[model samples]
Target: MESNVSELVERLGSDEDAVRKMAVFKLQGSIGDPSFADIFIAEGGLARLRYLTLHASGNTLAYSLTSFARLLEVDKGWDIIDQEVIQRVVELIVTHPLVNILRGAMSILVSIVSHPYTGNNLSQGKDFGFPALKPAVAVYPQFLEMLVNRLSSADHALCANALQLINSLMRESIANESDMQWPKFIQKLQDLGVIRAVYSLMQETALQDHMHPLIEFQSLTKVLLRKWRGIPLDLENPEHRRALKGIHLASLHERRSQDICIGTGTGTPNSKKHNPMKWRRLGFETESPIMQFEHTGFLGMMDLADYVRNHQDEFQKMLLEQSGKSGHQCCPIARASLSVTLILYEHFEVDKSEMDDSKSYLLLESRSNLDKLFEPLILHWTRLHIAGLHAFFRLWKATGAESEDYERIVELVRILIESVVGGAVRTKDVQEVEEEMASFEYSRLRGLQMELLELTYEDVWGQHLMQMREELYHEALQFIKEQRIRCLLQGAWFPSETSLNLGLGYEKVSWTYAQLSHNRRYLHFGGFDAIKKGRPELDALPEKIDLSLVSSVVSNVSASNDPLLPNEKDIPPASYTKITIHGHLYPVSTTGDTQKNDGQNGTLSKSAQEVVLLSLHPPSPSVASEWLDGLLMLLNQQPITAKTNKLLNLVSNYGLKIRLLNVRFNDVAFTAEAPPVPPRDDLDNDYYYDVFGGT
Candidate 1:
């Protein structure tokens, strides 16, 4: 371990920046291991790392800080980080010019502030002990103020990092809401201009094609929404009250005046002139009353009806242009506009108790717009996100049964839920194959007549095709409810979809898991062989090699999860697992299995399988283990034979298989009289045959 620490320290001093970054990254992961941590500190490796954090240049400096933060993540690891190092990290945040370095510094500060030191009773005393964590609390107010100021940085990345740090700090405060101190902490954040900064970020990036800023903007706004929901608005404090009402004050005052005019069918009296004010127009214009009089908030939240009223032409033009844009089917702008239209239609009120006899021209027009958006939005349904769906649900519940498009919208939603996923085998590929092989029909005479008629018609007639709808609103509602519960449990709001195929040559076939059977050559996904009707193993692999494999599944090491940076060879469209059959490796691609039935056409459809053989690169470690297990089970379940015993012993000797009830130590252990090695010539011949598919 000391030798390893020395090697790492030498790498950090090397001329190659990448080598130095890798050295720091490896040190971070090793810090969790007590042995490695002890060796690092004992060899003065920790002191070397501290010097690098303060003096290193470029990527090396960023990496050093990141590793330093990870070192402090472990419990009692705080003892290793002193007040000077903590102050240095804060200084980096305040003074670093490079975005990457600032991001690293921000990460380290976030770790320091977020560390759980409240309950620990260390050797120093009963209440607090760790000086590195203790000083952070004292300086937090100043540190947070600095971050809030950084929110206006010219660099988008720097601003985003600062926002992320503030968000993390806010999340902790929200989590400890039971403590009354959290409310004051939240108010202090507001006072520091955090909310305004978030709003400015959103407004700036609302229409950009870049996704990172938009994602960051959404995260910051979400934190504000949580604060709005958790704590009541402090109307007593003038600044706090103004901050809460700032975004919608003009609209709120207008709505209040409109409410008075709508109530008596006349405007309030003009007191200065001592004359009664006359009403201009009723609530039943082409705009809905909800859109006209919504008071609390509008910028961050969805208020489609109101938006359309304010900028009707621009909004409609945006929708039309985005819907027609080529490339991605779910155009962001188009989907957002359509989703808002649906929301407005779902919430429009035709008859309120206050306006029992009033005409609902506004609602009637809104429902008509809904009729247009419902079909178009469904055509690009994949573009809509879960948040949009939640908005739709809220609007539906608010509308109740009064909407003219209520039944129609419900039917459309049911069709969307069923048709978006699965139902049956798509015979389209098979049909195309058949069509090419079969004889062509005689359309020569009809084609000529149609050609002449087309010339006379001046334009080709076209029709929009849509999936047939079913009245399964109740089922769709139940599904939405279940999704809500799932979101609550998982803390993940987006629904995962099956990934597209990567087109892996001949191995592009979709493979599924089949049930273990007594007689089957190939274990197909259907649980039974349609042709062979017998269990079968891979012919490509040697029979002896197949018998020695074990099977286990694990998550693929994604770029983020991987300790080292990714290279060109490491990138792929899908996750993979690798299995070692004998000594040869094979890769298997894996993903979630999504199956559903199309209620409209009454068809059962299935896409690709959850697991498939890649036959390209090495599979993930988990896939390799699973394959090994399956191979072992296949051999163990067979009738006892010399070949089976030899294969099992080979695998067991390698420590690949789990120990069975009976100990076969004599068989599994390596002995002096092992199998004789093959000659070089024979080994070369076998390798050539395996590569070229020879006997």
Candidate 2:
């Protein structure tokens, strides 16, 4: 094998072109074997291959690049490849017209930038072998421009390769100190029209079928814009701001229309008119046929918000599909689109007082669309829920507390708090609960909660807070108690009984408290006003039922229909607020009942088996359904209803974090002095944190 490889290497210097091509082809095939590859490189094969890439053309050049890429896969290859060969490879990637040559060159470039030892060392400023190569590919302005230009290529394969190479370059750059090279690299790419070109590619109907690469490219562009350290365009400058707001350059026809005017002396339009100095003063040139800004960077020439608005339908569909998944299955396109939209909105829509009619209108339309898209899905999806809360906070700040939208946003926040608290009750695992409390979603939720508490300092929003004060306080208390209790269900309750004179009169109804233990061992009730006041003694609740004797739980109508009982019409048939528990009555005393039951060997006399009924009512239909499902789940019944099962799953998965969020909300909302805000989660270091900063 060694002798044969030596012969191939010798043929590369042959006089005939056919023999050299054949030799390169045979060498390309043998390079995959490690032993053969080492021998070929030792025999000066790498230098010869690099020479072929620059001097050869078509298949010969492509074959040489492919062989070079294969040699790069070996361990010793990077030690020998020089900076000139890498620079020539980048040139081939940009200048080559054929897809085959571009593809092979791109693969080689990706390998060089992605190699573990050399790539890592280069980014950290420690040179293993390729010191100059990093600047040749990543830092050089012309090289960055060449990569951005290939992004607009019509060939999908070439375009994808370009995107991959650019992404690799960014990854390498991010490892450096504060990504020091990123700002200049990103600025140069923007100057070369990369952002606009990428935006156009995303919207092209021809590229719709090949959108994975486009989506990744768009995502990378978003990251660069967000972390670029300084503003890319000056919003303080009127001309720059106007350009960012998407003022179109006037075409020659429009300029001509402005130039012509109807002369008062005649009933016909004049063929020519004096150039108006006013037009020039208004930033439109009268003498020049074209109108454009002095600074022509892409950031100044494009409206990112308008781009998002144009693709609103596509984004809506992606979000809808993603929100419907059972887990946090994020759609990269949707997340990237939303993140870019958010960054743009945060930067441009800062102060309403500074906005003109056009800017205000654009901001309002964008806000309205996002509100519609996120409102219905937030409660169902965790990531969208976080996003919805973020948008709501922005809306609240922009609209002020006096606007009607302010009240609506407050109501949404209140509902979200309740949902999160309710979900927290279902979590039982200590480790899982700890993990959730430490999550990114938890930090954001807590931040919003603190914001809401701050609103309580004002009279108008404080009234809304007062309305839910009792409820919020009660929930917070329950969350504290539930940490050790493992409560399955707990809420306000009303008990009703049959009367001899008045038929099923609820006129005597009084508010009471009820709780079902997680172990399904007992149902406890009593302490009404005390519990509402956030003070309750669980063991001293005054009434308890052994669930072992309970037979069934029912809703809506009465549990008994005997003639002696009150007529159904007398109570008007309790609908959404009704619950009935039926069980057998034991002859033993309520005290020491457990011991008495155990002495009876879990059996009861026939006379002691008489049916007993207990009727109760909750505050709402949803509460009644919750009680029904909790009871049914404890019974180990199969085929649970979908609605009940969904509620169960939500509580078990998201309940603990939400409860902690509510507790924090209440702590801030009720305190006299504002509490220190919780620290924001360190998202830059969390590997599981969403790229868009979701949970």
Candidate 3:
């Protein structure tokens, strides 16, 4: 264990910056004392963060820094700080070379303030001060004043995070000020122009966006103003109250205001459409909402081949990014991966009937092209990322959803796959390590292959496609347009058809994405395989590894009451065990609810909590009523025919009443519940989720 620890420490100190970046980012997943990992950012620690700010070329830097800024400071146990670096970071917040890094830094600062460690003594905010202070104030009063002022900088992009931090700090500071701290904390706040600073800043941002932070800040402002009346503050007003509410906090009120915000089409200047769906339904039965997509520009058959020809490194980087985007989809890199399987599928075995007529399609195996692709592929895997894959996948499918166009996706996935990932197969050249467990584990492979594909397809198009059925093939076309997935569609392999070739109950599609993200072999399984098909015995692994790690993972997974590789057709165990994630609670859904058919659609939807988040979090009824109404409708609907109904009742039925609860784990599709139809409506479902806690 000591040797392994030393190796980890050394890996944190790897000379290769890429290695160092990965170490820093992956450190967030450390199983041990996460606080210990922060020491790496110290003087003796890895200073890779410095390079990330300047080197914006490689997206690895952007991801690492962004991840660090997001997760690190939130860990209250991790109180590590380098004031000098922080000073630089704050200074660079507005002028950073990279927009992402700046956003990340701001997020980290907010997370830091959110931790329990925040206080007047240990922290600083708007400096309203009688210098005659007590030792309890660890942070100087003036520092607090500066922070408060900075927080209210009025530049939404600039001061949003700082503003939030200051607001929380003020809330705590005002409520907690005493003789033990600065003398007259409240009086000092009044004296130090806190109202002026905040009000001025609010005016500046009033004309801009509500990135949700505005609502939070407004609440804090209201709290402060209520205490200090005659400050030109009145929450009694609807706008004032509405602005104080979070996007989802207080749904009903928000809806009324949201309705006002969305005018009742008066024609000329003001009579306009808010959501495209309104115009869509009014315009045509299948008309779509206006959508803005970030296209990568590689479209059509020629564009597909040309994209393959020129941007091999870029493509591979994308694959690597996607392969490990979420913990669930982290697969093993083997000799034969998705690309290899694609080749095999094309050469050795071709399902002619599945092929669609295309203008031009051919195999791509030129040594030069592969060689160029190899460099990016290597670079991508070396870092392990996701931002790049979305870009790459979009580019690869820029043409029609032709099977031939998706050849690259299939090939690369096939080539890197370790073994029977999802249902796809891949082999590692293991002459020397035949008796050793050297390759990446199945958990990793299955997590990426089965999980993500299942998730992406299902969430993006599957549920709506299945429920709406053949009549909705045009809907698929619409979704493709709205989602812009059609722009990336490969015409031959996975092209747009006017029909559903396979029977896709919501469950299969959800699981397929789950399989793709993690279990790569899912494609080969055909969704019809029975459970408990064949439990592979614990055999000699391909590498000498820690058995305890494997044991811990299995224990954790089983502890959730998730099945232990059950037969394909077997009903999963009804687990009394409940797991929580991100404050979202997940209880096992019983078969009665899991299989319940709601509506004529036969769609199984999410539970009440899934439908109504405002039950725990007051609905921001003022922000948008349509989202709330849609949610309420989904919530009220019984498990008679809808996907969400079955899902909600599956956990714990509420006698057809709407009751929403919050849990640490919001993604419950994998929690031993029979997976329902894919959540096509992003508002209602999920195909898969990144398992956060377990390593």
Candidate 4:
């Protein structure tokens, strides 16, 4: 039946315009999940989508049509609109002819799925295979085929979005009513060939084996097969009753079906069949299988002999170790017999007796008593006892629920991780780490602790912490800059429009602050004026202000060599006055906008320079006294080159650039510095140059 629909869809692509529309209309109206737009994009997708969108009467058909390029452009109004329909119809539109007809598919999906307004109320009482609000189920086989076929296409978001849609479609049914009709779905699933397809997909590496449900599928199959024995395969037919004989595997040839279809990646997923699972029944214990062990008599006798041989020495050691011991201290010979006193609690410990006494005759008869007898063995082999508690802690974090004890442990773990990872503590974990201080060796745990914490963070905490760290740095920089601004005021300073980034009224205030500060040493007025008027003898000054601490990385820039040489006075100061500070220069004109102060070229662009707050001047003394007392608040932020950079590399967080730009200095002694030069323009106007790829 579905084959006819497939054949018609292929015909629509090559058929006459009128015939194409009819075929498309039927498919779109029937199955709203138009995923074929991906295929059309594969070769001459652009041309095809253009044809579809221009001819379309409305966005109805084009809405479902989307390719990776225009996925995010999808809108809500067009979301329910079947895209393939629109694609076929759009060939008629003359304007925007090249526009991908599949455009806005993502926008449509995101808008409808995440809409705060009309979303939830509109999606109700719809049955398309999976009880999902998804319109894809009516053509589930087609949708699945499209997805599997498009797996190799360059677009990842396409697959992601498709999966998201499928999950959304199946979400409610699988979660709420899984138990009610799961088995029946499984039955229908086998009949429609989904089980065989899924099994084949499971075997293929292309399917995500690590997906959360894949493990559950394997477990479910084992349980189902175990329960199949003695249970009738079909309750209605007497001849259908048969005991399970082999592993519960799905296969095209293995299934008992009326019309057996060959397995392909795409199989019908549509089924209103009630789930076979009983949620309330809970676990494999609900239905135990009747196993027919032909060699059970021989195996049981062999197991007794093997067990005696393996444990003969272990029993002797226990007798010698506990020659006179008794009670809880008897070295627990019951299960696995290993016990350790709880270090922190002093008295409360893992109750071994609980394991031994936990056995129940019916449901708990098999696996239950083994825990008691092998408790020591598990502790030795699995580290199960302590690990179980930590696992509980992890669950607490994941679920967003916390008890006082869990919360306290979390806080402690956070502190320990922060101190170590931030490099506050240097020594690696060479010693055992204690939870409390004094007993806690900060340095010893710092190295080992971060490694442990890294694993914890890789899951959930790391991503969250990284986001929080960025926010904190921005905040910290703001506070530091505010203090830097306070120091930027004093006695004398040069005004560089392009130099210090003072915008609006802030620059004037900063100028005023620099002019009136009490401690001075804020702002520079060098280059032209720094040269002694008539004396060449006193004009001598050092070359580079080599403050090694100013930066750690090798740079082309050296500290300012202020005041032009006595010989350089012969050169006239141009329209712009520039003073090189740190490694860069600050420039401002009595004219327009400024640009980056390149070494040879000082050409100022009108847009490059901006204004700083017209902040008040700091306290003044007019000499290097203030500088001697306190260091100039210089901002030297290099790109994130280390792991630390991983947390702070954002365009919004680029504070170092801003800090380096806004510097203030008073007239200070200089050796010999050249006056500012005209900036050379770049040959290529289209090319953009940036240090960190513009972050």
Identify the leading candidate in terms of TM-score.
2
Whole-model lDDT values for every prediction: 0.42, 0.50, 0.33, 0.32
* Candidate 2 per-residue C-alpha lDDT over 330-444 given as tens digits, one digit per residue, 9 for 90 to 100: 2223222233234332432222232252343355444223221111111122232334344443433333322223434444444343434234432123233333433325346
Candidate 4: where is the Cα deviation over 4 Å?
Answer: 1-140, 176-695
Error of 1 at 537 (Å): 89
Q: In terms of TM-score, how similar is model 4 to the real structure?
A: 0.20
RMSD of 3: 34.6
- Candidate 3 residue lDDT tens string, 1-695: 44444455566556776776666556545523545544443333334444444343344555555655644544522333344434444544534545555556666555544445335534553212222122212333354455455554445665665556555555555555453332245447646665445444433414234223443444444343333322222346453334323211221221321121123222232333443323211111122211100121101111222333344455344333433233222221111122332332233222332122111112223322322111111111211112222222433333222223344444333423323222221121222122122243433543455445545556777656355344334433333222221111110011111112233332321110001111111111111122223321223112121211111110121223222223434423222221111111233255422233467898756542322111111112111122222222322321121322333333222211112212224322232556577546546453455232212
Candidate 4 minimal-lDDT segment of 10 residues: 337-346
Global fold similarity of model 3 (TM-score): 0.23
RMSD of each: 33.4, 20.9, 34.6, 29.9
- Give stretches of model 3 more than 4 Å off: 1-8, 28-64, 70-79, 117-163, 169-212, 230-695
The clash count of every prediction, one per candidate, is 31, 3, 140, 86
Better of 1 and 4 by TM-score: 1
Rank all candidate structures by their TM-score, best first, as comma-separated numbers. Answer: 2, 1, 3, 4
Q: Candidate 4's residue-wise lDDT over 1-695, tens digit each?
A: 34555564464565476665665555444332334433333333344334554444344344324322233232212332343432222222212222233223422343333333235434852222233323433433344344333223344444334334333323333444434554454454345543433333333333332232332343333333323222333324332212122211111122321111112112233433432321101111122222222212212212222322444443344333433332222222211111111111111122222223333222334432322222111111112222222333333333333222343333433444334222312122212122222233433443444445545655666666567556767765445433333433322333334323323333221221122123332332222233234422212321222232131222111222233323333332211212223321234344533435555776544443333312211122222222212233333443222222333343233443233223233222234575686466765576654432342
Across residues 283-337, which tens digit of lDDT does each residue of candidate 1 receive? 1212222232232232212333334345445433433343332222212322233
What stretches of model 2 exceed 4 Å from their correct place? Answer: 116-142, 196-695
